[model samples]
Target: MTTEHIDDSAWISDKDSPVVARLSQLISALTNLTMETTEDLQVANYGVGGHYSPHFDFYHVTIQFIRRSCQIFCFRSGNRIATWLTYLSDVELGGATVFPMVDGYIVPKKGSAAFWYNLYASGEGMIFLRFIALN
Candidate 1:
């Protein structure tokens, strides 16, 4: 996976990027949440040595987000929410995105995407969102 940090306000630009832009818009539409609430929606490309360790999406509560979220409650209650993950490219092997629960696994399809949501809440009654690419 290739990782690069950017300023919080950096705009993403790339050819054939409309799918991701649409996905982001859909995310905003699906929930009352806003991306601005978080520092930034950092984007990365994963291929080799790119697996993400199991972790929570949000580090802590923020006044900009809801105190509790359907995401958390659904996860803890054994329910599932819809999340959208778009792949920028294809890999030969070992790059599926995996979640510890329900054996969540999605293969990379260039310009395609997957959707799922977390159902667990945080200690402070907050919601979390996270994902990783296995490479």
Candidate 2:
């Protein structure tokens, strides 16, 4: 994906995991966003030097609109306003969720998660106000 820089990921269904389902619900209520706010749970693995480059979640700009074949075949989808990522495993090294501009980061702890809105209250800018480094 253009926004995510990672080696690989496996999608996990919340329905198959009670913990994930509950976390999704909690995030929906807490953020005042729908449960749809949660992307599919992901089981991601990293090898040597694995890391995700900084990126934003929501669609920022559109290239064009209503092209002939493109628009005719396309279906609308919701804009992502936030992200919910919970770690299902632990990394002894090089695992963290970081807000670089803020100089903040969370070392991985199994079952811990990181959540944040992608936009400002005005809905016009990044809410966290910086690059969030997920590695």
- Choose the strongest candidate by lDDT: 2
- Candidate 2 lDDT, tens digit per residue, 57-113? 565545234455444333354456667776777787677777776778878788787
What residue runs in model 1 are displaced by over 4 Å at the alpha carbon?
Answer: 1-23, 30-39, 60-83, 119-132
Please give each candidate's TM-score: 0.49, 0.66
lDDT of 1 by residue, 1-135 (tens): 324321122335323377545656677776755544322234665445655565444333342344366446434543333345667788886777766554566888788866544444434422434445567
**Ten contiguous residues with the weakest lDDT in model 1:** 1-10
Clashes of 1: 11
Give stretches of model 2 more than 4 Å off.
1-4, 13-20, 62-75, 127-135
What is residue 122's positional error in candidate 1, in angstroms? Answer: 9.0
> Which residue window of length 10 is worst by lDDT in model 2?
69-78
Alpha carbon lDDT at 70, candidate 2:
47
TM-score between model 2 and native: 0.66
Tell me how many residue pairs clash in candidate 2.
0
Which residue pairs in candidate 2 collide?
Answer: none
